[model samples]
Target: MNRNKKNISILGSTGSVGTQTLEVARSYPEAFNVVCLGANKNTQILEDQILEFQPQAISCDYHKELSTRGEIPEKLMSLSEIATYNGVDTVVVATSGNVALIPTFEAIKKGKNIAIANKETIIMAGEQLTSLAESNSVNLMPIDSEPSAIWQCLRGENNHISKLIITASGGPFRNTPVGYLPNVTPANALQHPTWKMGPKISVDSATMMNKAFEVIEARWLFDVPWENIEVIVHPESIIHSMVEFSDGSTKAQLSYPDMMVPIKHALFFPDRAPKSNTTPFDPNKTKSLTFESLDQDKYPCFEIALKIAKRGGTWPSALSGADEA
Candidate 1:
């Protein structure tokens, strides 16, 4: 209720990004206030968050079932309602897939700044959402590491960007032979070398499809042309991304593969905050940083995603839907 505190409503409070965002809030309690929390069906974790944060309102898909069992809170509200609530200054759209699209649109219309980690929503309706956010004077902040890194690299620059270089860890299968890729199991694909993420995203990372999605996301988030954006395999995952200016100089953002770093960056935009729970990058410990061209044959899914992105219609939405399925 402090006037100086940022009132936040996290839409996917139980997910990886959402929980990390809460960790940020916890670290800077005096700076942020949890106005609302929303999730899908993880009632147990949701209840734990509710007990800890004591938000003004909460939302979940199983609200009906909870109400029937007399376990629902009095402050229960729908995701859209939680998003546009009067007390919320920023809405963190961390839910996966298209679930956050309508709520995100509604929040933008209501003039709330959005700190979003959902790529599907952006890939599906980036044009519409960006235009709407611009008209409403709302900030559509990116919480994904790659786009957030690009954003950080462009913070103070005024020159035109020649290219935006996005880095990928190449996932667990970066060196897997093509002949043995079909034999790779789900457990093997989930073993990301640099970061710990959800199953779907980990699998996407292995297939390089996540990098492809990040490519499309960077295109919209930075308003850069498709041809101007590039991706490279950086197995070290130290440099999140880079931006090259028309003058031929490039700036890069480096960190030790942490999702919380980007989440904190997006939440505290236009200002830098002290590090919380994130490790400082140590250059001496890094042996070598290498880059390579992405092989289209090794990741046909990545190639197909780029094709769908270039099509630039409802095809991105279809791609997202198909991926979700």
Candidate 2:
């Protein structure tokens, strides 16, 4: 297959995932270009990135910019603008919270490839986003590890996926003795043993709300039935997710905990651009992998998300909006 040099933009360009994504692009400078960048409010990093990649556009919520007097990129502004940039062939939606909801639609309507790292957007507006994507024939690649695994399994196979099994690290409270949960501090919750992410996401991981949000996202993103999706507590973070077929066979995607794998998959699918660093999975480094059922008493957010997904209306909007507030 002939590979085209793709132009890329990243939403939440200052976040952990976004920085790593830029690292991936730098790894393969010949295959990809950073066409645009969006961030909450961090002009220093944004300026540094702009100096490095020289994206055609940039967007900061206007809050993170310490020095507003500097020369800003002419195309820098709102997400809708980044999504529709003429040079933006792929839009990496790495922004946190619900902001990804509308931009996902905007990028897809323009038929731009969307590397979706935001779960709230789908939890809040899955049906609307996917419908728009379908109408416009866009690729909504799941940058989240688990969903990416599912996408890989479904590629060019007779994949009648019977069940979607999501693996979890069980968060900071995995062994915190249930009694200590009520006393869990924000500091303690911020300490995720497996993944390095933003504070809001780390907090959500501690509560298992992140997994719940993924469940809702998978349902709408792939048009899978609710019951087909299942969650398991895998203390070892190696197995991102699994898929069980109608033939009683199961397939899973595993790697050392890193967001770059999925991000790269989204950016260059049907082909892989050479990476600057090679971090292959080593089972010898990891001991045993265990799976267990989630204790509902421990995570009510899971049930609440399930309810919202079933209701299938603007209720998700209320949930996402209320949580954002």
Candidate 3:
């Protein structure tokens, strides 16, 4: 590793995005370093990743494993400690659900730059979270695809953006008959048509619940109105997302369906570093791009998400937690 590379701490170190993040850090030896890693129950994958990255610190929900092993590097109690480690510079909140909120808030309070991948934290507590970040002048780089696309285009311009049109791949049920939804088995729901993801997210996608969650996240993340938050079904998944400006112009961010691109970019904002496993995108050779308004009638989950964002306070938190139970 380069002596001058920025130190990074990745929460959720064994999951899909977290694994890709390690691959990016490995690929860019000169630009970044993994100083900390945290996981819940997947200690085996976590064990393998730790042996490779050799992060300065690590954490997991289980402490018995750490007790049994004596050769491991820095191990800590909390995400908050990982975020504010002495030599660590960038904090990546890759953990699932609202569990990331407090630790991410701890990072911001200490003035650490954050590369946020977790959406539940922002979806439920966005108003409070954004206000806290602003109060401290923290640079909250987005690791999610839609927000990153908007941020990339919104840079270096005073031009007003009128609408934030977040695209959805419409998941496995995008085409399953309307009445077929209630009968949608978890087995069918888990099969995402395009992206490879963990079980919770995969299930969320099929029910259109992830897009619903995104609606709320966008509301506070961009400081936009709930009504202005829009979703389009682009089953091809080529057009990751788009933005519409007040001057009648639209900017779109297109890439092949890969989570690593946004993950790497968020960690290395203001500078694009090299990474592996992402398919190179080519617009000319690409097949086709399609878009359509979200069918609220077919997908009531999306509508409930929008309504929760508009209503404000506790409801969004309740729904997300209910999913966990």
Instruction: For candidate 2, report its TM-score.
Output: 0.93
**Which runs of model 2 end up more than 4 angstroms from their true locations?**
1-4, 63-71
- Estimated TM-score per prediction? 0.96, 0.93, 0.94
Comparing 1 and 3 on TM-score, the stronger one: 1
- Model 2 misses residue 123 by how many Å? 1.1
Off by over 4 Å in 3: 1-3, 66-70, 274-277
Q: Return the lDDT, model 1, position 236.
A: 92
For model 1, residues 151-217, the per-residue Cα lDDT tens digits are 8898877359999999988889888988988999999999999898999999999998899999999
User: Can you write out model 2's per-residue Cα lDDT over 3-118, one digit (the tens) per residue?
Assistant: 36788879998888799889988888778878888887777888788878877777777745446545566765788888787757788888878777777787888889788888
Model 1 segments more than 4 A misplaced: 64-72
- Residues 1-325, candidate 3: write the lDDT tens digits: 3459988889888888888888888788788888889898888888888778887888888745654344577466587788887777788888998778889989888888888889888877888888888899887888888788777777776258688888898888888789777887889988999988889989888878888877777778778787776889998887767778898998888888877878877887777765456777887886678787778778887777666667777887887786666
Give the Cα error of residue 2 in candidate 2, in Å: 15
The lowest-lDDT stretch of 10 consecutive residues in candidate 1 is 64-73
On lDDT, the leading prediction is 1
- What is the C-alpha local distance difference test score of candidate 3? 0.80
Report how far off residue 68 is in candidate 1 (Å). Answer: 12
Give the top-scoring candidate (TM-score): 1
